[model samples]
Target: MPTSSTGSNPGYVPRAAVRRRRPAQPTRARTDLARLATRLTERDVWLTEMLHEHKVLTSHHITALAFTGHRTANRRLRELYFMGVVDSFRPLRTAGSAPEHYTLGKAGAELLAARAGVDLPATGWRKDACARIAFSPTLEHTLGINALLVRLAANDHLPLWLSERSATRLWGDWIHPDAYAHHGAAESDQLLPFFLEYDTGSYNLARLEAKLPGYAALAATTGTRTPLLIHTATARREAALRRRLAEPADRLDLPLATGNAQLADPAADSWLPLDSTGPATGRLTLSQLSTHWTNVTPALTPDTTMPTTGRPTTLPWRPIPPRPPADRT
Candidate 1:
C-alpha cells in the first residue's frame, strides 16, 4: 500500500474520513384511518361528526355535550388531538385564558368523508380549518350560537340542531337564521322547531327589523310557519327588538317571539311573543310556543321525499349526536 498515506494501517480510516451521522429526529405519529376505525368509539365518532358540522366547539361546549366532567373531557380530547382527529387552539385574551376551541382536523375530515361515502375534498375541510375559524370575525357569534345550543343539548331535549351552514344550505335563498333546532321535553313526542336569531345588540333596531321580510317570504313560500325566536343579549335589547319587530311580525303574520339570553332555562317560560297585548305577566315555554302560534304547523320531519310541484323540500342535516351510553356501573 506504499506506506498508506499516513502511519495508519491499510484497513484503518482517519477520524476526518469517518462519516458522522446526525441524531435521528423524532417522527410525528402518523394518522391511520384503519387504525382509527378500529380504535374510535361510537361517542368519539359522534363528537367528530359534531365538530365537522358545527365548525368549532369550545372545550366547555364539548364537555357539556358529552363528557361528565372537565377532567375527563380534557384527557379524552388530548388523546384525540394527538391522534390528529381534532385540532384545538386557545385564543389570546387580555385577562385569563380562553377555553380551547376544537375544530375538525385532517383525520376527522377523512373519517367523516368515509362515513359519508365521499372523498376528503368533498367534505369541505381544509388544512387550515382550525386557524380559519379561530381568526374569523364571527368567532364570538359562532360561539354564542353554540353556547345556547349546548345548554339546550345538556337538557337532552334537543333532537335536531342545525348549524348556520346547514341551515343556510337548506334555506339560504329565503332567510339566514343563526341556527335551527327542534326542542321539547325528552319524554314528549311534541317538539318546538324554530329559527333562532341570536342578537348581540351590534345591529341597529332598523337592521334587525329588515330581516323580518325574508322570514315572511320564507313562510309564505313554504306555507309552513316556522316560529322565529330572537334571543337578545339583554332585556333592554329584547324590548327594543320586540317593539321594532312587532309591527312587521304582525303585518306579515310571522310567528315570532323574543327572549332574553340571560334566562337560565331556554326551554322555560322565557319567550315573549311580539303580539302580546296586556302587561307581560308570564312568558311561554318552548313547547307551548307552537300552541301560542296556533297556525304554526309541526316542523316538517327531515326527509328526502320529493315534494309535489310547488312546495319546497326540507333537506335534512345530520341528526343530533346520540346521548352517551348510560353508566353501566
Candidate 2:
C-alpha cells in the first residue's frame, strides 16, 4: 500500500506493448465459422448497441462499459470493424490519435438485431452493463484461464488465479482478483480466500496506492487478507515497492507476498492455484507481472471504481452460467 504523497504527483512514462497471444485477426465469419459464430460474445454485441445508441465512443467510454481492459476493448473494436459490424472512422488527418472516435454501421445493426434477448445484467458493480463481462472467453488452442478454472473444478487440473477483474463491495468496482485453488480431489471454491494486487512502476504505484485503503477496508470488514501482492517485473522498483509496503502493510496484518518474497505460507496467501499445483510450489509465481513503478500518483488517485457509480449486481462470471433448464409444458 502506498501513502498519500504518491497521489499528489503526476508524470507519464510510456511503455511498450506487453506481448500476448493476439486473437486471430477478426475475420469474415461464413459457412462453418458462421455456424460457429452466433452472436457477438456478450460485451461485443452490447457495446456495439450501446455505442450506436450513445452516438459515439472514446477510449474512456470503453472503460465505462467494462470489456476486460483497454487493450481487450481495442482489439474487439478492430474485430467489429473487420467484420463490418462497426466503423472506427479514424480521421484521415493523422494515422495516430490520442482518443480515437467510433461510430456504428450496418453490420453493427445486424449484430444488435437480436441483442434485446441478450439478458446480461443491465447494471453491474459500476453501473457498467457490459455484455462481454458475462461469457467466458473460449480457447481454440492452448489452455486458458476459464478452461483452467473448469479443469481445476473438475479435478482435471490444480487451482490457479489468472483472474483479471472482480467487483466486490465494502470497496467498489475495484480490481479484486478471483481465487481458484484446488486441493486434491476437492472442488475448488468459486472464490479463493483472497488474492493480492501485484504492483510496481509509476502506473502500478498509483493504482496500488489508491487501492490500498480500499483493500485494507475490505480486509478489515471481511476478516480476509486480500493483501496487495506486487510483482516487480523490473530490477529497479523492487526495492522501493518492498520498502513502501513493509510498514503500512503491517498495519493491516495481511498475508502479503511478492514475486521475490513469499508471505510465510504462499497457500495461506489466498492465490493458490486450484489443483494445489500452485503457481510454482503451491503459490503464485507469475513471472509476468510488474513492468512499471515509481509511478507518481495522479493515474491511481480516483478512488472511483467503475465508469458508473453504485453497486453492480453480481452474476457468476468466472464460470459462464449453466444452460437454462428446459421448460416442461
Candidate 3:
C-alpha cells in the first residue's frame, strides 16, 4: 500500500486525520412564520397561550401542565426553542443547575396575535419579556405561584388556574392576588374557587395584614365570598402570618385560610382556616376546606357581567386554556 499520510510510518495517523470532527453548529431557532405555523400542534398552541398568560414557566412546570414525561417534554421544548416559538433561560443557582424557564418568543407572539385577530402589540408580548422575567426580583414568587398551580393541575386536574396577569386584569382594582384557582375534591363534584396568595416570607406581617381590606372590597363589590388561600414558604411563617392576619381577617369577615407549602399533594390536609378559635387541630384538605366555607359560591360564567359607565366587568378571559386534544397516531 502507498505510504500513509503520516509520511514514513504506515501505522501513524496524521493529525488532520485524527482531528476531532468540527463540533456541530448549535441549532438556530426558526424564524419562518409559514413553516412554523404548519408545524404547530394543538398542544403547542396551548403551551404558547399558557406562556403568554403565565409570563414565565420552568421546564418542570410546562411538563406537569401538558407533557407525560420529562424526556418528551424536553425534546418537544427544544424543537419549539429552535423554532422560536418559546425562549428560555436557566437561572444561576448556588448549588445545582436550574431548569430552563420559558417565555413566549417573538414567533409565538405573532402566532397568538394572528389567531386573536389582533396585532403583535395587542398580545402584550415584547422581545424583552423573557429577559425581564428571567432577571426580575419576583422570579421566585412567580415560580412559587406556578408551582402550586402545577401541582393542583397535574395531580387533581384542577378546573381553573388563572395567572396573576389575568387575575390582575379582572380584579386588580380590588386585590392583586398572586393567582386564582378552582380546586375540587377527588370524590365530590364541589369545586372551590379561591384567590391564592403565595407568601415567600419576604414582606412584613403588616403588609400581609394590609391585603385583607382589598379582599374585603372584592367580596363586597362582587357580592361573592371567595375564599382567600394564603400559602407560606414555611410552617413557622404560616403560623406567624395566621396570627398577624387573624384579627383583620375576622374583622373584615374575609374568608381566609393558611397553609404551608408542601412538596406532597397540595390538595391534602394542609390548610387551617383562620376562623378557628380553639387550639391546634388537624389541617383540612382542599375539599374539606371548601365545605368549611359554605358561603363561597361557584365561579360565575365569564360573560356574567358587562361593562357600562358605572358597572364592573367580570373576568373576560377564561381561567384555563382548553385541554389539548389527544395526540394523533
Candidate 2 all-Cα RMSD:
14.7
- For model 1, give the 10-residue run with minimal summed lDDT: 1-10
RMSD of each: 16.4, 14.7, 12.6
lDDT of 2 by residue, 37-108 (tens): 474565555455444433344443444334436676577667766665655432222222323345554455
- Global lDDT of each model? 0.72, 0.36, 0.71
Better of 2 and 3 by lDDT: 3
Please give the ranking of all candidate structures by TM-score, highest first, separated by commas: 3, 1, 2
> TM-score of each candidate?
0.82, 0.36, 0.83
Across 82-102, the per-residue lDDT of candidate 1 in tens digits comes to 777888876654333456678
| Model 3: how far residue 183 lies from native, Å | 0.8
The lowest-lDDT stretch of 10 consecutive residues in candidate 3 is: 1-10
Total clashing pairs for each candidate: 0, 25, 1
